[model samples]
Target: MSALAIILVGLLLCLAGALSVRLAVLAAGFGVAWTLAVAFDADTGTTLLISLGGAVLAFVLTLLTARLLFFVGGLCVGAVIGAKLFVLVQGGGADLLLLLVMVPAVALTSGLLARRFERPFLVWATAFGGAALVLSGVGRLWADAAGELWRPGTTAGVVVVIVVWVVLAAVGYSVQRRRRD
Candidate 1:
């Protein structure tokens, strides 16, 4: 059921991206990378490490072209979504909430910070992964607080994901506005 939903999302994303050349390229790149990762059985830590490496590559390549933004953004979003899928398959509700919330939040914050502070790749990598670890702990706390957790939607993870996505989407819009300012 959940697998079907995720597949539907991937299809929709591909369809939407196909409407534009730029989006199509992004979607294709993401699909290829995701497929490779899955085929390789890349675990959560490995995926993060690979993404961090890619982020560094993008940062370095940014010296030549400003197009690194696309790579960084793509890598961050892909990693988050991929990690969430892994959690959903391997872990329970607690793991799902931890990855889903922490991954996007960390990725977004780091990407934004990288631009604002001109930070090193190592800094972004460490901060992002460290934040995820902290959030995982917090998820465990919430799991403990909750009397029982069977399905994710009924648990704290669902609430956190909903709230976080709403807040992040708003923040993303505001950031876009400020960038236009």
Candidate 2:
């Protein structure tokens, strides 16, 4: 039940995150709380209370530290860009020294870019993050319910999941971009 709730909340984020920053934060909190609640095997009442608590926490935190969150989000975006760049560089048989140089450089560049374009950055960030969250919740729920065999129950399941995530992310990105404009 809680797992399903997480999935629903994640879906909301994936589809409409950029419509409202507060909604994105609250949805993230709702998904996280429900995901945790699934482990507790609690009654519906307790789960609802926990989810509400999570939302309240999200509200308070966002109210208190919106700017900090934006900065941190920029840093996080930088980290992801750096990681991807690292992999691309590694493909050329790059060495440790190059990695040490490249990652921070890319990260710094990305952070600067994010700082200059906060809304667009948030849209992309929320889209991908929401898709990932949805995938996680679905995977967890599927595994717990089916025992052993995951999502699609076959190797093709992996491909399917990846494709689905990409599509979701893309759609979310488009929707958020439109909304932002």
Candidate 3:
């Protein structure tokens, strides 16, 4: 992966893990900003500018219209879930039909979940999203180091990654819940 991709992934993991609950509005803002930056294929400098702009926009919009912030957060969370699902199902294949179907479905499901259960949804979504990003970054780094795609010599490596991801996500969730209480 490029340095930009690594940086973006690291920022996402940090936002989701540390700031999602304590500073939910800020996290949501940054999440939306990062998503837009990536979607637009902004260069590093442009991406930074867009991210900062989005953060300010999110903060202002959040204060002016909290519901809108929630909706935006839901949309960002849904998009992340959709992207992850697409990666898993695509598997080096290009199927427009599958993409069309799966993307909307996952996004809608996640969005609805977020709308229905705002606090819990944010907590879990952020944690899982962070974990997913961390795992993805690690996988990409491993691939770069090994000069190949991520095919572990044994299942142990994959298992370890999954375990670590789950543990990290659980820790994030617990920390957020405790803070909330």
Candidate 4:
């Protein structure tokens, strides 16, 4: 991916992670709608309409039920993690079934956790989601430097990226926790 694209993706991830509960409805709804529209090869206007409708529906659902919001937020966070993991594992020749399994497993686990832990869950989920995005962006940048898109670079480089991701996530988590307190 281009540097600009990487940056934009990173920023988006950070935003989603930081405000997951607030944005979950719109993100999940529009994301699913867009995916369906593209899968069906819908026209531009149709896609827009579908996405907007989905967003509105999601907003109403989430606004009406706090529990649903938590579940959806967790699902969205898990989906992000699942996608990142899928890409990493796919590079190792993982099967389609594995990808499918990973997504629901992560989503279910996260949803349950969110239900059980409430605010703490949101904080951690957002932190981890943001970290994953940051890691992916850095990885892409490294690959670009090496004339590739997703190539895993040296072990040292990988370690550095992971360390940075963890630190940033910890900071985010702390900040969110403090805000809640």
Best model per TM-score: 4
The C-alpha stretches of model 2 lying farther than 4 A from their native spots are: 22-67, 74-113, 144-157
Q: Which stretches of candidate 1 lie over 4 Å from their true place?
A: 1-63, 85-137, 140-143, 146-160
The 10-residue segment of model 1 with minimum total lDDT is 12-21
What is the lDDT, from 0 to 100, of the residue 137 in candidate 4? 66
TM-score of each: 0.30, 0.47, 0.59, 0.61
What local lDDT does model 1 show for residue 64?
54
Q: Residues 62-134, candidate 3, lDDT per residue (tens digit)?
A: 6676555555566676666566556555546667888888877776776677777765777777676665665
Clash count, predicted structure 3 = 0
Residues 1-181 of candidate 4 have per-residue lDDT tens digits of 5755855665555544545555766889998888899899999999999998888888788768877667777888878767765665555565789889998888888888877786668678767776677666656666656322233445554455556657877876877666656
Report, for every candidate in turn, its global Cα lDDT versus the true structure: 0.44, 0.67, 0.63, 0.69
Relative to the unseen true structure, what is the Cα RMSD of model 2? 10.2
Q: How many residue pairs clash in each candidate?
A: 0, 0, 0, 0
Q: Is candidate 1 or candidate 2 better by lDDT?
A: 2
* lDDT over C-alpha atoms for residue 178 of model 3: 78
Clashing pairs in 1: none
Q: Tens digit of lDDT per residue, candidate 1, span 86-154?
A: 453444435656667666765666556545543233233322332332233334445655322212444
- The residue-by-residue lDDT of candidate 2 on 20-61, one tens digit each, is 668778898988898788788978989888988898898899
